[model samples]
Target: MKLPPIGSYISTSFIDWPGHVVAVIFTKGCNWRCPFCHNGPLALGVAEELDVGAILDDIERRAAFLDGVVVSGGEPTIHGSLPSLLRRIKGAGLAVKLDTNGSNPSAIGELLNEGLIDAVAMDIKGPWYKYERLTGKAVDVESVKRSVELLKSSSIDVEFRTTYVPHLMDEEDLRMVRRQVEPGRWVIQLVDTRLALDPALVGTASPERARVAEAFPDVPIRG
Candidate 1:
């Protein structure tokens, strides 16, 4: 089976899955160029590709201590063979979580239908109007909405995440996202503007993290 372009691997992470420890696969490339993206190299596919097989072997060796594996991005769903990659990890006795930008509903639905993913964490860019602006790409907003609807009705676990980027979005924008999706499991993250894909945003002012959290009342991913 063909493997996706694996850019980087974290052998273990406690935060990626919140309550559980898991290995992380940061895939190379993305369909959208979200300026606030922190993984500039990976998103641009400039990060050196790693041996995916070896990393899977490592995770298999350490599987006893891990609760799951998180397939992150550069938009994990963008990879056509992502299900194959997840199957290998699942074979290693690790549950899998996928992080995505909600740009591809078809991929997400396919993975769920095939029982390849145990959970999905999709990022909500902002209100629909801000999508093209934040992503710096021509976007089909309906695709993103379809992703949300798929996750919303899925039997598996899901979390709709939105980063509170002060420069790119406001509290009202976040509220609009919540109103639009009404996800039961939702989280609001504060963007660290010090580092971003767009250099102009670096060192930009951000809202108070505590205040943002208070307003959003996060549904913890942690168990």
Candidate 2:
């Protein structure tokens, strides 16, 4: 069976999954090109590949200590083999969390319908109007909307997040996102410019967590 392209792996992470330790598997390649994206290599498809068998071996050994596996990207849903890979992880008796850009609602729905993933964290990069601008690519706004609605109504746990880039995003933009994903958890993440895809965005200061929290009093601000 063909395996999902595994670009990199993190043995352990406390923050990727709330209240649970997880091993993060980074998939290669992404459809969008958000300027502030820190995982440039993964997005550009330049990251080194790992043998799927080796990765599974490691996961099996660490299963006793791990709560789950986080299938992050470069946009994990882009891979057609993602479902198969997720099934293997689930077969190991570990929970699965998927991090996506919300560009592929069909894939998200398939995974949810098949009971493959336990949680999902999707990036809501501002409002629909600013999607292309922020993502630096022509995007299908409708597809994104579909993904948002799917997660909101699904049985799985979901969190919609936006990287708070000073000039690229603001309180108004986040408010627009909130309106679309109402009654759903919206998290505002502080941008980390240390290794941005767009070199010019490096070193740009992000808004303070408290300041953003004050701006969107009902939302959660994370760094």
Candidate 3:
């Protein structure tokens, strides 16, 4: 099986997933063009590339210290070989966490049903119309909607999040997102404008974190 092209790996993370020491696998390629994306190099496949073997070797060395692995992206679900990749990680005896855009629900479902991923973090990148605008793609919002429904009903631990980019987001947008997500584990992330995909987007400011959390009174907010 072809290994997913790896961009980088983090030997340890405390916040990538709550309560787990995770080894993060950064995969190359993405289908979106969110202006505020911090990992633009990964999204554009313009970063310094590394051998997948080296990444796995590093993971193997850290496996004894880590309790889990997080397969993050450049949208991980876009890669066709991710199931096999997840299987290999699970075989290492570490639990798996997948972070996705919810654009490819089937792939997420397949991994979940196959018992490969133990936790999921789906980025609900604003409302459907705004999603197409921000992502720079003709997206079927229903695919995301379906994914949300599946995650809500699935047995695995799931969290929905939105990266708060002030230039592209507002109170109304957050309201719409909250309605769609209901009362699950939701996170409102403050954008790190300094690392945005486009340099022009660097100076934009988001609402105070406390205010953003107050906007969704029923959901939990984390930094």
Instruction: Please give the lDDT score at residue 202 for candidate 2.
Output: 87
TM-score: model 2 vs. ground truth? 0.97
- Please provide, for model 1 over 56-152, each residue's C-alpha lDDT reduced to its tens digit, 9 standing for 90 to 100: 8899999999999999989888889998899898998889999999888999989999898998889889999999988989999999999999999
The best-first sequence of candidates by lDDT reads: 2, 1, 3
Single out the weakest 10-residue window by summed lDDT for candidate 2: 213-222
Q: Say which prediction, candidate 2 or candidate 3, comes out ahead on lDDT.
A: 2
Task: Give lDDT tens digits, candidate 2, residues 1-223.
Answer: 8877889999999989989999999999999999999998899889998888899889988898999999998999999999989988988899999999999999999999999999999999988999998999999999999999999999899999988898687778878888988889888888988888998888888788778877888777777
Q: Give me the overall lDDT of model 2.
A: 0.90
- Candidate 3 lDDT: 0.85
Q: Cα lDDT of all candidates, in order?
A: 0.87, 0.90, 0.85
Give RMSD to native, each candidate.
2.0, 1.1, 1.5
* Top lDDT hit: 2
- Look at candidate 1 and tell me the lDDT of residue 164: 74
lDDT per residue, candidate 3, 12-76, as tens digits? 89988889999899999899888888898899987777787777777877788999999998989
Candidate 3 residue pairs in backbone clash: none
Q: Among all windows of ten consecutive residues in candidate 1, which has the lowest summed lDDT? A: 214-223
lDDT of 1 at 147: 91
